[model samples]
Target: MRPIVVLLTVLSTLIFPGRAEAATTFGPREAGVNAWPYHDGGQLPKKYTGVVDNQGVRMFVHPGITGGRKMNHPVAQAQYGLALVNNYRRTHDSWYLDLAQRQARRLADTHVDARGAWYFPYRFDFPLSSGIGLTMRAPWYSAMAQGQATSLFIRLAKATGSAEWRRAADRAFRSLQLGYAAGVPWATHRDAAGRLWLEEYPGPNPATSARVLNGHIFAIYGVWDYWNVTRSPAAAAIFSEATRTVYTYLLRGFRNPSWASSYSLRGDVPSEKYHNIHVNQLLHLHALSGQPVFAAMAEILHGDFTMARVTATIRFSGGTHVGVAFRSTTDGRVRARRGLTLGRASSAPVDQRRRIGGQPGFWYHVTKGALAGFWVQEFPGRRSTTGPIATFPYLTRRTAVLAKGSHLVYRASGPSVARVSATSEAGIVRLGWVDGRRAVLVSAGSLRGLWLVVTPRTTFRIAEGDDHDEVICGVSCERVAPLG
Candidate 1:
């Protein structure tokens, strides 16, 4: 009977392989746009108009700071720039490209030092403090920011034929590479052995400790990008060494087969539970690197350290810090219980938990009464109460439509979120309400032979495709309906 069930599952996947094609969209919906109640510039209530100057060059919504100045940290600046570059690639809008260029210039002028090694202010609040000063030259900074900047500049140079951008990217990569000492990159010069170090001293020491995993992972990611852009054998070798070293340490120091534990190199027992978004990014890196052990570790972390079960409490007044815990569950559903506090840090914890149900994915507070986003699909099977899921949230006024056919296009007026199922078998897609409007389309594929249902409330329309054999429907929800 078990073998029969397995065979049926395999046959279903083969007949309807939804995994072949990439999703129409990827990444978190609320990314770049500030969902928090903070005053970040780009996250303002206004419509996103391609990172305007008035909106500021930095993507973070914080006021008073403009251009890359708004982003004191090299990592933050790189992430913001990367987001802009990605947006430009998707939309082909020159504004995003221009914004990335401006930020890159600012980074080159302000962050890159006389030593040709790029370093950034560790924190926006700390001016010329020692902690900040030391981190400015940290190898972790180079590892995270340089590759992103290089990738962005390379793309920009090609797009606009700007030699300056190309040169700047080359300089940045060379500077970052120069920061490495011996096989192990120093987390801080304040220490010998070139071990990992943390900038936020007296709080949590990340250097020379196993906690270097976070920085190590970022370093690997940057090296990967460097290899992609330059195709340099040196970059490839660096990537390989970094991956091997981190994996060796992670497995030896953190792995606990019994608990399926893969901690943040903190070595403490409960510290393993705190592994949030970093674990996911590492999993992605492992998958990209083609390392079986890293990939296997990723799976274990995902299965055991479920983020859905965890809840966060954040106080962003002075600076951001959060505590996380796995939500206690009774029957398979998360109980509406208070979240456990995991402590705080400088920034919001990364949201790494896979989605479940037809709900969107997020790590912060969800406005319960307010309609935000909904979940659409789960991969590998029709649906598992527990598994990897995708969600689409329409935060703006624009409406979206997911056509019915196997080959369907989901659309949004501006930047919208669409969740594609991980697998094609019994895949489901969802859209959030936009002033009470909805639309749906259908396609004719083998997967269509199975009965598929889409429920839309408020206003809707049906568009016939080719013949009667193909039909699509559109719906709108104004009065508010429960999304499950």
Candidate 2:
């Protein structure tokens, strides 16, 4: 019976590809977990500690599925490679390293086309299709998937000093940098403005030729990462040019201080969702480049109150220094209610006993929910907020603020309170505990700077870093009093 199911899965992957459901013959009971989320057979390997960074909390791979469901989504396959690398970094585990190499080879060999185009079916036929990039929203080979896969290959090459991976990375990089001959009229094209934009799909009018903000951002970030590691001149040129293109598009189209979920290459925002995806993406871009424009764009997109909508206010049992960060939309509407009782972060903030219940909604999890650890420590609800809010540097320590035309993105840690002082622009917000060195980047409106802080919630400390020298006033901070 098991062999039959496995055979079916392999056949489905080759034939239908993205339209097939995962095989459910493999059970979570074998993996020692009670009930699995998403794909049934998938499990967090027992050895995984779920600690942040240098290790993934969960593996979306399912034993019953061909390529363990990673092949179902292009980004997932690449991220799996990342997880493999991260696990190796933490445990010095040879198993993970070997698995990563094998995974990379399979993906490149099976999916990649002659023109370096990856046959990425962005939509999956799974139950949670609506929430994720299902419904066949975009084209087969999206910038997000290609860019991420390229980065994964490059990273693998750097890690193992393998020429095959490097060659693979180069091919994908070319397809991304220069539009591939997708072999169909509408497969790839350029907009009237003469800017190159990949076909999101081979169907329909608008969907056929378009660009997604997050997709472009992800690809650009991946290119940047590749350049950072290898310092390849070709990779660097592509990264620089792509960054400029995205920056220009964002400034012109997303200037309303809010954004539609995605926009076409012709600069038409198809539809708008009340979400923080744009904010998070911009924040990530800012983190990568430290460019004021990206920070400014983040400040604008931060007004989308999706983060507030996902937040469930839970009380802490012990005396832990906690803070709540809020973001509002352009219409002066705040999504967060002042005091709603929901779940709580563990007073023993260090304890990882309380796992979030069930899988978060696909869109929520990708845009904001995945980064919930950086905001809250833990909670019982599938969507809960209950920890130090480290969304932004300027207001990292604020308990609450009237989020009007402003968005807040933060990551917090530690149970005890500590006095942290940066430039004047960098407010005196009560941050959660810090195990070691954590650098904080603060930006409220035009004020932006990197500050000397302690370590990330869970990370190894590095050498000493420099501190900023300027000071400025606070914008919307709540807690001005110090903790006793």
Candidate 3:
């Protein structure tokens, strides 16, 4: 029933556009106070007459009441606060910052338990039995909600010079860390015998295993943030182990070795799935860990893009449009193209995969000024057993590419030949030297809108080679010459 309700809400959100604006009708004043009150599942009154219930809680019911009232769960509140903070960051809006702080304060005061732990009940109506209710207090739920709360608190503390919020965040972090197993920090929940459990709500049936990797990843992010704030080695160690476990176990098993179809713990991989966000997160993790394999996997996942069959509205031709088909494959067909201004056109149908030297070569399109060109390279396969291809500049203003054997280097700054000699970090791709002046590197696979960090002193020159191959940077190259 709960899952069904969640699905319905998600479906409604997908079907009806502009629902968020309609839902937030009060614009932060509907709850009768400056802060928004938590709503249990039910319709809110159309009119905000500033009414208070018997328990002194504000009436937060939305319009369109239905079975199961909406209450302010700690996790939801935390997410709300995070969203507000994000908005504030973008707009520098004081109203959003104030609202976010108010909610953060409320969560800190109400959710932190007497045992210095943090937990929230399943709903406002649920009794605070056994310290917290199962629905809200579940390890997975708490980690997510409390993790956001912690992040918000830390951000607030930094912004407002508030030690109280910082303290609350620290307490929350401690509570979550203590809840996990000693060494296996990746596991979210634990059994009574103190054994690590991967799935948050593991049911008796194998099919009901609720082991989604998102929650664990969120928890790790929270821990990593905490470590950044305090520089605690303990926190850093926990974060590292959690990352290692996720990449080594969860991610590896989720995708097919052939890099086709979406990987899932519950059987067949779905087509046209958008787990690219997850893949992106893993890429960041790989960067932090410097692991080559994880880097390679990220490249494969992104480069060999798959599409799921989903219907969505896309804006094109500089006008509001609708009814666009979205697929999971990297080379899926686009139903329509919109938003083209003059020579500026959408490159949605570009085929990145190509064949070179008995191997599958992939080409990425680059456009600068009125000029557009194609960058061609080979895909990394197990049999190749080489490093990245060659380091060059991606046409994108801030991106640089490197090739080390069969591995590809995508950095924000230019890569130094000296730095490439170091051992690759865990879960990242390692580049090997093909020669003194040239090296081969594999692609990090399908990434978009991500920045690569490179060295500041390196210089590049554009030189045209055979088969339309353009070299942008070399060991002693100084000038970048454009190829016509």
Task: Assess every candidate by TM-score.
Answer: 0.47, 0.50, 0.47
User: In every candidate, how many clashes are there?
Assistant: 33, 23, 86
166-195 per-residue lDDT for model 2 (tens digits): 888877666665553434222333455544
Provide the global lDDT of candidate 2 against the true structure: 0.41
**lDDT of each prediction vs. the true structure?**
0.38, 0.41, 0.38
Query: Which TM-score value belongs to model 3?
Result: 0.47
Task: Assess candidate 3 and give its lDDT.
Answer: 0.38
> Could you tell me the C-alpha RMSD of candidate 2 in Å?
17.9
lDDT of 3 by residue, 1-484 (tens): 1223433442333223234223211100011111111111132222222332343222334443313443455555665566666666556767767767766766766663634556443333221222112232222234555556666677677666788878877877765565443322222454333323233333332233344455455566566556656777766666655654554443345554324424334443423333554555554444344333343344334433322222211111222212212232244344332222423322222222221112122222222221123322222220111222222211111112332222323334433323333223111132222211223232343322222222212211111111111121211122212111
Which candidate has the highest TM-score of all?
2
Better of 1 and 2 by TM-score: 2
Better of 1 and 2 by lDDT: 2
